[model samples]
Target: MSESSQSRPVKVTVTGAAGNIAYSLLWRIASGDVFGKDVPVELALLEIPAATRAAEGVAMELGDSAFPLLCGITVTDSADTAFDGANAAFLVGAKPRGKGMERADLLAENGRIFGPQGKAIGEHAASDIKVVVVGNPANTNALIAAHHAQDVPAERFTALMRLDHNRALSQLAQKLDCQVGDLSRVAVWGNHSATQFPDLTFAEVAGSPVDVDQSWYTDEFIPRVAKRGAEIIDVRGSSSAASAASAAVDHMRDWVQGSDGWATAAVVSDGSYGVDEGLIAGFPTIARDGRYEIVQGLELSDFQRQRIEASVAELRAEREAVGDLLG
Candidate 1:
């Protein structure tokens, strides 16, 4: 280990640690790809009791990798144990939406799970622990968690919309035949589901403002990015794990290390862009010194306003469905 690695280690807790997304995420974090290579990390991995054995297997693999920055690892079935003194957390475990189930069903089911986890975090985690909810119905699930975790600052909890944001960038880059890094300021608004608006109105490509074909933007681009998960499932026989994990890393890393440009995340809104106050919604954001702030002063077009309203409505409905969990 280097001298830097000998410094105080940051503790990171990941729920659903044996699941596919966590499987992809743990290795990157252990290798210091999320936090700086110089910053040592101790991983606290959590899963249900049933998955404890699988989590042990994952720990074995992590041990085999011999990550120089990884100082320690703990696998647990208890949230309180997993979150104890955690500096950061990834809430990647939730009951997935099964076939023929409605979105409300998923939200209610996850509410039961996140509510307890949130209470545990509030009671056991570090006061500054930053959380990212990566499971499906993530925005509302994050809201439930934050609501229950009253001791933790509500802003510290956010949902994973970086996946949608990255999807938008990739789709635009493919159309323009440019690298994904050449794009900036792309934002995904409102919910993480089909109602999301992947707006390019504020985006720039290759340092020039993007002026895309309206027909393509409406017909091809928006749907492609919004439903990319379904598209992947159709082609790959499974829902996205790798891409989702990569986006989670991007979200947490940029959040802690500072973003190079505007990134999108689903954060608790204080009525920005007319989103309901206290709602967790996606917005164009920037991170600095380990905090995320929604980008301010950007004027939205009428088209953007209408699309955003539609999505916010969906979020409001979700909040209503899980109203009891909020308390």
Candidate 2:
């Protein structure tokens, strides 16, 4: 067998290459530790034409890292060319709401971006390409992207929820004054929106309910995790970009490297949770063999069900808003 064929190098494409997530994501992917020591990675960066120069600067820094397992780097404005031969893709770019912009406008703008990018990936990305969307309005944007990428597996597109999941776990731990390692199976449900339900009933500390008799829930817990995103925005005067970026790295890392914990993510539905079959919705999941299977049959309390349904409503609304644009 040929030595190069034996190695099976992975090519990772980062769309929105000049964005904050890509800045953090590229360095980690190049370090070879992203997929562990044995797997080598080639980075392909896709940036819009207006952002290409800044992306080049990011690529220059990647060159300086000198990571041993980084096989190559390719940067381009063409999504088709950038995604070509890619085994994994991080869809992290989208139009940010300028001052006074509406949600419909944001969805419309992102539809324009993800639709073509999705088509490009479908046309040129390797057959095994696994895509994760990190941009805002992620769930529907992933749906839009997935719809256009007909050749790619529908299961291949997913949106980021690891951040919300991690945030929920950390807040619960801190409120209970317990270590984060003690928490397991925490679920972040519905859209990656203000209404997302962070269900802790099934989460365990020593295989027991995380509430420990409801002390944490009634106290400073739920609000802390729910408001964490706004907290960052309040303190920073800008929405989270670093912690968000860090979450992107963690999502791709665990997806490629393998992990034991159930990582929650917004994946396109196949009628899970009664969410519309094509709308991407967040659920508790475990990633195995580079795929995520939502943990099923969780017992949902009335309160939790209401919260998740609210978020699902938001996602469904986004789908409707972007419906005409999808074509």
Candidate 3:
């Protein structure tokens, strides 16, 4: 009934010890982001040996904070050990886009890492374990990990869609001149890549339909959110790490903590909207009972359907590319 009861001691595992996002996320989890005031929790941090000290730095911070609900912390290089008994595992480490590498090359590099981690999770993680991929090329990387984790249900795996979902919420708020909390029903469709589509057709800004122009949709809004990652990279000289971390926390918080009145789009296994069964696809979703179910039977306008399909096409192409690489 409570967060700890629903998952228990909530053995949370975070990959990438030296990474910026994981650093941001670890302390917050230790401080009891989801477990509430009375619940207890333990943390298992996974890092490469090179970054174990940094992880320890974070562990030291946790101890210094002296959060009452924080029971214990463990840092390790072994995925098997880090994931053991973990109720939730966050895959946050991945190779980023280098100067000369293509997208396929990046996906291939991540596949090599996530595949074994997936198997480790399947073999050792707790029975109700849930995974979220926060690294780049998240959707396909999640597929790779899920495919390798043969023992786990495909639906148990998910990639972070909170960034896009938040972008849409923010945009709707701007359009309607209202607060983000009042906006609901926004959806992001298809891949998490540059091709993913944000659908505002059913979303309400301040409880009213968002009136946006198609020209602005094509010229301004869609491109803005889709390319926001790149813009962040240009300005910050690093890929989006902080906001990505925040989105990851928001995602797990919403998933384990419950959204109540709010629902956001998340990329889960495609069981809704006619997407192929195993591919990671985005849809309007709410997290409850340790699982996310895609909101079904929403009315779609002609324009929205076309845009969603376009994004799905891109996802299918990536799937094919990865499948070939696996072969």
**Could you say which candidate leads in TM-score?**
1
TM-score of 3: 0.93
The lDDT leader among the candidates is: 1
Residues 31-130 of candidate 3: C-alpha lDDT, one tens digit per residue: 7775454557888888889889988998888789898778889989999999899888889988888889988888888888899899999999988888
**Candidate 1, after superposition: displacement of residue 9 in Å?**
1.1
Clashing pairs in 2: none
Which lDDT tens digits does candidate 2 get at residues 1-327?
Answer: 135632977888998899877787788778765666667888888898999999999989998988888878888998888988988888988888788999999999999999999999889999878898999888888999998997788889999988898898788787678888888978888888777777887888867876555665735556666678789889888778777777877777777666798878888788877678878999888878778888888777787777778888999899899989666
Tell me which of candidates 2 and 3 scores higher on TM-score. 2
| Model 1 Cα lDDT, one tens digit per residue, 105-139 | 88899998999999999999987799999987999
Worst 10 residues of 2 by lDDT: 211-220
- For candidate 2, the TM-score is 0.93
Could you estimate the TM-score for every candidate?
0.97, 0.93, 0.93
lDDT of 2 at 160: 91
Clashes of each: 0, 0, 0
